[model samples]
Structures are given as structure tokens and as C-alpha cells.
Target: METSAQGITPPAAVYEIAGRRFEVGARGFADAVAEAHAAHQRPRCMCLVVGVEMYVARLGGGYIVKRMPGTGSHHAPDCPSYEPPAEFSGLGQVLGSAIIEDPAAGETTLKLDFPLTKMPGRSTIPPTGSEGDSVSSTGTRLSLRGLLHYLWDQAELTRWHPGFAGKRTWATVRRHLLHAAEHKIARGEALLARLYVPEPFSIEERDAINSRRLAQWQSAVPSPGKPQQLMLLICEVKEIVPARYGCKAIVKHIPDQAFAIDERLYRRLGRRFEAELALWGASDDVHMVMIATFGVCSAGLPAIHELSLMPVTAQWLPIKNSFEHQLVGQLVADRRSFIKGIRYHLQGGRGLATAVLTDSGDAVMPMFIGLAEEGKLPKAEAVANAVGMGAAAAWIWRPGVGPMPPFPPMQRARSLIRCA
Candidate 1:
């Protein structure tokens, strides 16, 4: 059985609610949560001496604890809600500008550069090779790819630990993605309402799943003289094959369903994500994750409008190149806790941490991979600047220079699992 580090149970999560200390899973915890929600009282997570504040969110009929806005990094590294600082990744660029959080309302408003609706009789513009490479020129709007990256980050799919191996299934991923979409608004519509993440396939429940899917998709179906309402789809790509007229994307878990893609969009997709496609094709363990805006045609066919692809390891950690693949492999083998960095809207040449070592005591260590441009090594100043804000120190690995360097020393292994 999977155990935390060396099998010791970490301290149970404790919170100070309404001036009283309560442990999660303890008796009366539910009552405390309900009271806090009804009284609008924010619970403080007692992970550290000062404690980090959290908010109660209603999920279904019950409530869940969520980290407050901009407070993820303040929690202890071993805390279940710990998140690496935004400066270590492209999230720093868009946190307050493109993404705005209202702590009171518990909602996030996103300014997207892409459209959620497509007009009938109008041709969709094919994406250029550099469309999602960097933040929009205004630096205040998220690109289609940026939005996908944000969702992935918010879902905490970027985090990894040894105990999670073989447990991160489609069901787990879908649950987290849906939870992340809650209370998020894009273009004045609730993101959760517009997002569809396929449920894990179950032969016993296939018909029920299909029925729910069709019912949810009706909102996006085209009607006479009406603009096509588009919905967001996040799924694993099974294959892209030739259909009778145009190409189609066969998504995993949905065996008999496929999303149609036009010739122009298909060609552009090939050009825009050639590296990602090649990397995915090279490894059987790699998962090709696709995020797209899709709408149902008059004939009930789902057609893709704008989309982006990201390659992740079997553990679902995002990786861009062979170097990242190697780095992530070593981290997993070593059984360390870390957050994988994602390039939301940053260009390929821009410096970003590969991962942040959270198990290290006190301060987090940011790992950097130096990508040589044209035949020249990256400047030391540039790498330092990337590692400057919020990081304790830097772990540099220049693949072109030599083999991977040793990772920074980690604190003694301790269980992060806690029981109330």
C-alpha cells in the first residue's frame, strides 16, 4: 500500500474556527464548518505558528475548506493546501491582472482574449504558430492556452508525491478540474457551467454517462439564426484520424465519440504544437492533454473551435522536453514533494523553474533548466532574475553543458498524511 514517505502519519490538519481549535475529521467538524459558512466566518489553518486563513466553500450539500486568495504559499510546505509561490512560474504574470479574485464572493474573474461564442456563417480564424506563446501584448488578458494552464495549476495536478503513483486516474483528474472551475467566471458566465470533463469510463454505467453528457451538451447546440454557444472541453487525446470529410479528435474514455476539426484548424494545430505532438508520440507513458472550445453542430456533432495541447508524464505532471522528463523522473524516484512549474503564457525562451522542491526545510528551492538558444548558453543574469523573487536558492541544470546536477539537500522524510 502507498504510504506517506516512510509510513508515519503526519499531524492532522487543525483549524481555528471562531476562536476555537478544531481538527479535520474530528467530531463536530462538520457542525463547525456549517456554522462558519452560515456565519461568514473564515477558518484559519493552524499549520504554522501564525496560521493561514481559509474560506469555506459549499460543494454539493456540504462544505469544503479552500485556501484564501494569494495565501497558498503561506501555508507550511507539508500542509495539504500548500502551493508554491507564483513567481516561480508564469502564474506571477497574470495573477492580479488577467485573473482577479474576490475573496468575499469567492469568485475569480478572468479576462480572456478568446471568444466563447462563434457566430454562424462566419469563418473561424486559424491560430498562428505563436498565438499562445506569450502573454497578450496588453498583458491583461489570458490566451486560450493560458486559460488551460491556469485551470491545470488551480487543480493542483502539477503537484507530485510518491504516494500518488497509480492513483491519479481520470476520475481523480475530472473531480479536481471541476472543483477548480467552481466560482470561476469567464466572459460573464460561470466556468463550471461551460466546462465539461468526461467521467471515467465504466462499462456498467456507460448508458447513464452518455445520457448525462448529451443533456449537458444541449446548451451548446446550434439553433436557427443563433450564434453557436461554445463549451470548454478538457480531455486526453486518444487519436486524431481522418473522418469522411474532415479530421476528428478521438478523446480517451469516450469510446464512440469524437470532435470534428476542420482542415484549416487541423493544419494550424499541427504547426502550432508540433513539438508537443512529437514528444507525446515518442513516449507510451506520456499523455496528450487537450483543451478546446467546442460546440454541437445542427446534426448533433461536436466540432472543435480553438484548442491547445500539453504533454504530461504518466503521473500527470506537465513536461515540455526530454530534460523535464528526466528531471521529473528523478524527483519521483527520490520520493520528494514538489510542485511542477507550468509556462502559462511565457515564451519558450523565457526562464521558468522546472519545479520547486517543497520538502526542503524552511524555504523552497526552485530548479531551473537552462535552454541554450541557437548554440549559445543562457546568460547567468537571466537565470538569476527568474530565480530572484521568492525563491531561497536555485538548482541549475544545463543539459547542453553536462549531465543533470545533484538536487539540493532535502529535509529528512516525514509523513505529510494527517489524521484528525
Candidate 2:
């Protein structure tokens, strides 16, 4: 009680995050203030630590006290030891390991922010010739500042223990970023043409990113044979920046079969895409595509690559008539069906992060999502609804022939059985 700030209410002093809260007591107030201040000072370096036992719980008119070692002790020169209650579970161990087990422990609990932001739903890619002769025909360049801003834009990292304000720990930021980059990289060749901006993402970070990306691409052993019923479409969206002339995008296409080999092929296949619009014509927008498989080809080799022949569309499954009438229930439960599919594919542990260049001079960001992996097409649409995403352009690339983009998927939803 000695450390408690006089007149400060318990409700006002405590804050919650990710299902946990920071509880400061009269005796623990001073230490909490010092810890929070120190962590805030080096926002980038701050790693969160929680003390499970310091909390008190009430149940059915009963009171329970949770206290661990070093509750009232001074900062020790040695690490403190405490056992978590059974109900406290896994997070207890995660937080405990992250705690600073120092010989001089100034605080009993430490809490850091989410550290980095989540990937933005949108991003921009620079187009060729936009630099107005500043860049060579064969040159490939990336913007360092733009990449930093993208990393900063992630909304998820706002709650991080210390905000990114003045905290310039590139090493910690990069470490956290690489973890996220792993998800994109694991998608394989379908994503190989897209560029990824991992934090602490300096030129130095390229090697690590490339190595991980390649490793992930090589690991994806495509599903044996073709999928029955609905088809699979892998899309990578890139923000476009127009060059001196205008904006142009290469919507390269990849077959489901190519996913078995290194997805890097998708990147190589970029040359096959084509555009008739004058360069720099569309510089004010971001360009992306949804490449999917269509009808069989003459060679019967899955056509290898093709574009624009057919438009993209979605079909829903049969559901009980009673459930169909419940619009709110469908909206509430079916949301995020698509994003969940992308997440499932991402978690499957294989795929590439494609790096695409825009003909537009403006900047672009790429997002990769899968349509077939999230159970079925209907669920994927649900996910798209949850995230406010719509139909995307299609990419199909081949030698001599450039990328041919198909029309965006129809926005309206259709049912498996005709609506009675």
C-alpha cells in the first residue's frame, strides 16, 4: 500500500489488453510507474512481462488473492521465481520467460506493446520510368522510407508496451517483422512476384528476407492432383505508381500445378503479362490481381498460363431455408470466412511472397490471399466480407504473350441451390 498513489482509483489505474490487465496496488504503484516509464523510454526495445499472481479475483461472493514472490521486495540483483496457478495457463509461461530475470530487478512486472504493426490491407508499388530517366532500364530499386512507413502503418502494433515514438531499436523491430514475413513467404511461387517490407528492413534485411522466402517456396509440395468441386485461385495485389508515361501493371498468371515446384517461377513469368494503356496513365491508384485456373487448354497441360478468357465468379453452398432468412446471423457468423482461409494457407507453412513492379510511377503494396484453402469458396467470400475486400484482377503470364488480366469477380453472391 505504500507505493499506491494517494486518491488514484483502482479502476482508473488499471488497463487491459489481449485479455490481461496491469493491476497497480498502493504498495506496487511506485514500481509500476518506474517500469512503465522505463519501457516507454525505449519503446522499440520494450518487451512486455506480466505478474499473474498479483491479481485478485471474485467469484460467487468469494474473494481470491493471487500473490507471487518479490511482491514487496526491492529490485534484486538476481532473477525472481514464481509458479503460475493452473488456470493462469500458457500465457503465464510466455510472460514469465520474457520477464527480465536480472540480478537487479527494479520492478515485479513489465509490459511491452505489441511491438510492430499488423500488415496493412493496402500498399503501393512504384512504377517503371516514373523517376524520369533517374532509373536505368535494367535497374531494380526499393524505397527505404516507404517500407518504414508501411511497417509503421500496422494498426495492431499501436497497443505495443511502448509506442514507436522515438524508439529506434531496429534490431528488435526487425526480429518481430521477420516473424510476420514468414507468413507471406510460405505461400510459394504464386506469391513470388510480390515484394514484402519486413521491419528493420534495410538493404541488409534483403538477404534474410530472400533466404527465408526461398526456403518457404521450396518447402511447398502442392496438393496431389487437382481439387474437386471449387477451384483454387491465388492472388497477389500490388499498389501501383506510374512511371513518366503512365501506370501499368503486369498481372502474371500461375497454374495450380506450378505451385508444386519453386513458386519463384511466378516471378519469372511476369514477362508474359501485357498492357495496352499508355504508361503513367493511371498513377493515382494501387493495382492488384486475382489469378485463377480456367477451362482446359489444347495441350491438356493445365494450359500452363492464360488470361482474360473468363471472368471470376463465386458460388455458395446449399443451406437450410430457415437459416437463409436470418440475414444478421449469416453476417455475424460468416464474416472473415475468406481471411481465415488465407490464414489457414499461410499457417500451412509453405508459399512465396511475390514481388511485383508497377508501370505506374506511384508506390504500391502487395497482399496475397488464397480462395480455395479456407474450406470452400463461400467461406472465402465470407472472410472477404469480414475484411471489406472485393473482387480483384486476374493475372496470367507466358513467354511471347504478356500477362492477360481477367475481369474482377462478380460482387453479388449466388447460392448453390436456386433460391426458392
Candidate 3:
């Protein structure tokens, strides 16, 4: 077994394929995996004693192992495929109900509260607040922002490690987003078919890229008698500026095209995401990520219906404020492995862990950053409730109190023993 720097053995990336154990780097491992994929065999990850089942996915003519749906928490914490318990974030509020996973079929069915097809003569109601604040009446349908968070989580974009610094570019983000959309079904339509992530721009092949984009958007073009199909767009915001008639949103990598936003929707966006906009504007290193549903008009113009904005650090980890920004930066500097928590439909005042450190000791540590306003810090009860959910130990930083306390010390990697 390979040992880590601390002299403890980390969980081996081993799997049982067709009743045989194969380590990731062993000879003929690739051939064994390919054969298993061809034979329609499910591989079991040996991260735990009993091992958790995994599936093989084909990507770019290569195959990759993926965890079974809803089984992420079953693996050892240090396992590469390990995901925190759903209860750790907003995912717990909707998983298995709003989001249904079919392990046998390898698909996820999403029940969305928003409309995917709009009538020609009807106007969509302007959103009163951010998508994360919109609650479903039955508490079983996912809001637009909830969908975004789900995709981001599945893409592992919420995960951070010091090794990823300076390596997360638009191309990487887009690739992961598209991959996450695979096998996702929303509104009886494949999510991949209705999703648009801009490809990296190159002056040399600009025309080809534009052609591909236009082709992909053809399905969303307005039809005279049929309901207009709307496509979901995820991109980094370059700017939102005044257009000839109303306003337009310019996204990175799609400089030639802009998504039109009417004055009312623009105002709503400003009101809904004021904090995100402010946080993004305050730092040059920050990036504004936008997820919106839009449709192509008969005149070939793309108009947005509903949208939301999230601010991420330079490393692409989501942050709600300067305090989170500071905490994430410190974690990266210390070479920590952590998962960034996302608030789906949770209210702004509700306390949630900023990030959960996975490499700390025997149990995961949830880190909280308290915001102070008018000499008042976040409520003690709210923070306690957030911590009471699962974690035993938590690290909190109240900017109003003093400097951030020292983080929990990292523990040596432990070996995962397989059961006989």
C-alpha cells in the first residue's frame, strides 16, 4: 500500500470488477475496466469494507468511474469519490423528492417549479427575489437556483483543494458543467439538450464556434403557434449594461452575442442579487456566475426570463461575502480539502456552514463565518441549529469579535480496510 507524507496509508483507488480486485494503476487495469464497461458490469469501489457500487461513464472516448446515485456518503471520507452527507446543505431539503435518481437507468429526473416553455402572448412574472429565496408551495419542486446548485455540486465545482489553484479556467468549468448534465432529465426533456455552455473563444476559429452555438440554440427559437422553448444558460458575467431599448448581459467567451434583459427584469435582477452584485464589484479577482433561462425570439434575439447570480472567488469557490472569501483563501493557503456549502432555498438570515473541512481529524469540521451588522452578530441559536444537524465540531469566525481562530489541525491519512 502507498503511504501518505504522514506515514499513514490513504484509501486505495481500488475497485472490484467482475469479481476481481483491480487497483487503479495496476497493469491491465484499463483493459479490465474497458471489458467491464463493454460487458455491462458494475464496479464496486473498495473505499469501505463492504465496498460501494459505481458505474462507468463514457467521456470523450474514455471511460470514468462514477459513484452510484445517492450513495456518495457511503464511501470513506478520504475516498476520491466521497461526498458529504446530503444533510450538510440545501440538497437534503429536496433530494429523493424533488430530485429523483434512478440507479438502474442511470438518470436523474428533476421536478422544476419554473416553466420551461412559454406562450407567445404571455409575459412571465418578474421574480420578487433571488431564486434561492423562492420556496415551492409543496416543498417538492426545485427552483431555478436549486437546479443550479445541484449541477454545481454534481460537477464537483464546490470542492476545493490547494492543488486546483490556477487550474480552473472557463474551459474546465464548462467541461465539468456539461458532464454534469449528462443523463439529467428535466421537464421530460434531456437537460443536456436544453443547456448551453459557451465554448472557449479563439479568434482563429470564431466562425466555427458561432456556427455551433447557433445550431445548438435552434431548438429554442420561437415558433408562431407553438410554445417557445427556453434553454438554460450558465456562464460568467462580463457586464450588464444599457442597450438601445433596455439592457443586455454580456457573458464571458461569447463577446459577439448578448442576452437581452428587459427593464423590469433587469430591475428585478438588481433587487434580487444586490449582495452578489456588490460583492463581485468590490474585488477584481471575483467572478460573477450567472444562470438563466432564455429563449430566442423570432427576430433572432435571445431574451432572458429568469436569472440568478453567484459570486465565486478567483479559484471558483462560491462565496457569499468578504468573510467567506477570507475563510476560503485561508483554507487554500493551508492546503486543506473542503466542500463549499450552497444555500438552495434557504433564507438569507439562516445560518449555514461556509465550508466543511474533510481532512480534519476523525470527523469532518464545518466552518462558519458570522457577519456583523449594526454591532449584532448572527444569532447563536441559528448557528447552533446549523451545527446540530450532523457535525460534532465546528469552527466559527465572527469578524465582529476578533481575528479568525486557528483551524482544526489536519490528521494523518488512515488506511481503509476491506471486509472479508
* Per-model tally of clashing residue pairs: 0, 77, 0
Q: Of the candidates numbered 1 and 3, which has the greater lDDT value? A: 1
User: What TM value does model 1 have?
Assistant: 0.90
**lDDT computed for candidate 3:** 0.78
Candidate 2's error at 285, in angstroms?
Answer: 15
Model 1 stretches astray by more than 4 angstroms: 1-11, 131-138, 372-391, 412-420
How many steric overlaps does candidate 1 have?
0
Instruction: Give the alpha carbon lDDT tens digit for every residue of 1-420 in model 2.
Output: 111212111111232222334343445444443453444321110011232223322222332222233231111101111111111111222223322212122122222211111122211122333221111222111122212211221111211111122452434433443332221211122112232222233465666654663443332212335321111222322322333333322222221122211123233223322221111123222122223322222232221121111111111111111211122122213221110001101111222111111110111111222233433222333323422313322121221343222211212121111110
Q: How far off is residue 401 in model 2, in Å?
A: 53
- The lowest-lDDT stretch of 10 consecutive residues in candidate 2 is 336-345
lDDT: which is higher, 2 or 3?
Answer: 3
Task: Give the per-residue Cα lDDT of candidate 1 at 412.
Answer: 31
lDDT of 2: 0.23
For candidate 3, the per-residue lDDT at 413 reads 36
For model 3, how does the per-residue alpha-carbon lDDT over 1-420 read when each residue is reduced to its tens digit?
Answer: 322333223445889998888888788788888887788789999877788999876654677778887687677666778776665576777888889987556678999998888998876754474343423424488787788888988889999865677899989999999999988899898999999999999999999999999998898998779999999999999999889999999999998899998888787777777778888899998998888889997767798888877789888888888888888888877778788988776665655678887676445677767665532233444443543323345677878779999987777434557532
Once fitted onto the true fold, the runs of candidate 3 whose alpha carbons sit more than 4 angstroms away are 1-12, 25-27, 34-41, 57-63, 130-138, 371-392, 418-420
Q: For model 3, which pairs clash?
A: none
